[model samples]
Target: MIGSLLYLTASRPNIMFSVFLCARFQADPKESHLTAVKRIFRYLLGTQGLGIWYPRHSTSFKIVGFSDSDFAGCKVDRKSTSGTCQFIG
Candidate 1:
């Protein structure tokens, strides 16, 4: 279930934070975790049109990038996790 949600997150950036929080419990998930995960699915069901979109128009090319991190935000273990993505011209 988490795997599917994580996969969808590639295009659904809106759910990134919620999905990442639930992902921490995949190793030993409990009922609460399952409920939280289900909530995400329900959210998706209600907001299926939400996703990344780029206008198909000619424009000056430029580099794009993003960075994210969890500062001691680990749920199971106290480990800082960081994620970054970049698009260079």
Candidate 2:
């Protein structure tokens, strides 16, 4: 199930964070993790119309990216967490 969700993340960036969070427990997933994955599937089913779109023709384009990190954000491993996003227009 995690594998399928990871593959979908390529086109459905909105679910990337939640999917990856649930994936972290793949080695020893609990009941809660299964519940979370089910919630993500439900979200995708309801949001089928939402997605990123790219124009086929354009005279010019601009790309922008933003990223942030938190120091020692992970309670289990005491490791930093970071995320990034890119926008094109």
Candidate 3:
């Protein structure tokens, strides 16, 4: 199920973080992890019409990117998860 959600992240960036959190527990997921995954699915169902939009014929053609991550954000392991998004015109 996590695999399917990861594939959906390509079009649904909003669920990326939740999916990543659930993915980290794939090796030995507990009941709480299952609940979280189900919640994500519910969210997807409610927001099926949402998606990215790009404007055409922009006078300024440029590309921008941003990324940030917290240090030791994970409680189980002192690991950080970083995310980035890019916009091009």
- Candidate 2, residues 24-45, lDDT tens digits: the string is 9999999999999999999999
Sorted by TM-score, highest first, which candidate order results? 2, 3, 1
Cα lDDT tens digits, model 1, 6-65, are 999888888899999999888998999999998999999999776545556738655698
The number of the candidate with the highest lDDT is 2
Q: Which TM-score value belongs to model 1?
A: 0.56
lDDT tens per residue, model 3, 1-88: 9999999999788889999999999999999999999999999999888765666777787789999988889999989888889988
Off by over 4 Å in 1: 50-89
After superposing candidate 3 on the true structure, give the runs of residues whose Cα lies further than 4 Å from its correct spot: 52-89
The CA lDDT at 76 in model 1 is 84
- Overall local distance difference test of candidate 3: 0.91
Worst 10 residues of 2 by lDDT: 50-59
TM-score (C-alpha, index-matched) for candidate 3: 0.59
Residue 42, model 1: lDDT of 96
Better structure of 1 and 3 per TM-score: 3
Candidate 2 TM-score to native: 0.59
lDDT (0-100) at residue 13 of candidate 3? 80
N/CA/C clash count, model 1: 0
Question: Each prediction's TM-score against the native?
Answer: 0.56, 0.59, 0.59
- Pairs in clash, predicted candidate 1: none
